[model samples]
Target: MESPITPFEPAIADEAIADLQQRLKLTRYPDEETVEDWSQGIPLAYVRELTDYWSAEYDMGRVCGTLNQWPNFLTEIEGLDIHFIYQRSPHSDATPLLLTHGWPGSVLEFRHVIDRLSNPTEYGGRAENAFHVVAPALPGYGFSAKPRAPGTTVQKIADLWIALMKRLGHERFLAHGGDWGSLVTQAVAVAPGTTCAGIHITLPVVAPDPETLESLLPEEVQALEAFNFYQDWDSGYSKQQSTRPQTLGYGLADSPTGQMAWIIEKYAQWCDCEVNGLRHPENAIPRDELLDTVMLYWLTNSGASSARLYWESFNNPDMAEIELSSAISLFPNEIFRSSERWARKKFLNLHYFNDKIAKGGHFSALEVPDLLTQELWQWREQLRALEIVA
Candidate 1:
């Protein structure tokens, strides 16, 4: 039998906050990057500035406060306590929607858009578009309990999510995700006996169709270039996390600055922050919001535990063809973009294909919640029109 669900509020002890402040106070920053831009990495000057604000000016209680405002809960799934935010839409007939986040992000990524999704009428959206939203912290991330043993792969997480939704009385639900979340969402869509009605993913893990190599469209050519860039310059973190997460964890677990730099670098690199020949994370997400994500890692000391997900699942992903109803959204600045034709090769029942989102990046829910929400709305409308979702 499943463990009884319990309400949860993050009651961080004062000592934890003090310890974080003290760590920030004692941070040993590295020398400034030789280049003026973020070529080498996040500029050391920006790290110092961010750490100064984090230690001195930022409100440490905001993470707990923001999480407390949501109806949070925990339940044992597969012998692990899973933490999640559950919001039932005011519209009783609203479709059940599971929202998952990727690496370097937490359930906090959904903070801006949870209520908007759960109560669409409040945001000038049709009531028909409302969703009974469920946003869960991945195992070993955020408040979710870390796995003590190996084998908690992305496919395993998908099974846990399916079980969690059934425990919440959602027998059939829709799903959406990006990054690692997108992989899990796809896994959920294809899991045996899965009750997932459909899925929408921003990062569909479909390779370029070999057939299209000779006559690549401009979009496909740009996608291949971006993929090459990621392989060459942007994927170092994945390498470390997938291979030596434990070795790297000691510094990140002990130093708040280390954790911040590790995560914030991704935010700057992946966000749609470039303008006028410059890129700044703050250009896409606010400083406090950026720190909000970092705080989730810092407070829980979850750097290593979270990175372990990569170690367990990154090297071997379940890239099976998705036979369920599916939708794909290709934001221009996304790390791995898929052309509609490329996605068509893998997602057999892809009912919605959009590559024209004018803005946003990997962290779409946080970076461009409105656009993401509209995409969800549009995906649902398309699914409904096809009678795939009712």
Candidate 2:
């Protein structure tokens, strides 16, 4: 039976571009933060400069062209149009790998690494390490259709992805994700009817075992401090989105600058972009790429719809014990860091674990594609030793 997947390409209209340019020109300014650093939020001066570039210099066509370069398609899964980039490897023996993106990020997060994963030899990687990459836009994100009704949780998205892979002709595959993607990938790893061979994640959504607190390792202590910091200072956005996303959506939907500031602030806060005490998102990811992610939200008017995922699933994450073979890479600046002991508590058959990443943060795929690609390649070797993907 043939799958009902339709080829997709973004047909952004001239008027939408004109409207964005005009909106940028007419953006309302706010008073600068009193603090010197980003203690309050994204600096006003930087926002103005970036928005100006977006208005005058940046090529709006980059978004369309970047996605069009890959094999993008739309398929109806559970009555919603799910958008994804299905890039097959030139290597015939490559395994299928599902890459899911999280909130404040779309499939754009995987843009740099997709080619690296799907076509390894072209980028100096062994053909045996290649994979058929399937990066899907979360429901209500990017070109994917929004959920009009309620109850589109992470678990539902996992089920949808399982069906999507089978429809695409892959019965068994590897899965990798970070942030919200990590949670969905967990669901896929343990979903009852899933065919997942193994899993790798940057963020292991495992809580610290109470027993370990009495004799905490140095890294475990730092992980606790980071988790506390997130709860104290950085979780305001999560609170808003999980509580009243619809109310937050109006501003994000109407003002281009509002949308830009909302998303870029996370990149600055979550990315390992700091140098000599100052943090700038452009240090980790280029300014154009930062704007590229914002444009996906602006063009699709998905500011509110995307936030609702938090409303539906943030408070109710699926944290079941995963017995599947698992590999976890703990990036230094990720929001929550877990030690191998903690991860082993949840991932019973843990195959690989590394917390020695010298750099990179929550947005690892964007900040350090080379390092992220290397980690994936390393994980594949472990799977191969066990014959998980041959």
After superposition, candidate 1 runs with Cα above 4 Å error: none
Model 2: per-residue lDDT, tens digit, 1-390? 444988998769999999999999999989999999888998999999988999989999999888888999999987889999999999999999999999789899999999999998988899999999999999999999999999889999999999999999999999999999999999999899899999999999888999988999999999999999999999999999999999999999889999999999999999999899888888999999999999999999999999999999999777778999999998899999988999999999899999998899999999999999999999999899988777
Error of 2 at 309 (Å): 0.6
Q: Estimate the overall C-alpha local distance difference test score of candidate 1.
A: 0.93
TM-score of 1: 0.99
Candidate 1, residues 249-302, lDDT tens digits: the string is 999999999999999999999999998979999999999999999999988989
Models 1 onward score TM values of 0.99, 0.98
How does residue 360 of candidate 1 score in lDDT? 95
Give the CA lDDT, 0 to 100, for residue 30 in model 2: 94
Clashes of each: 0, 0
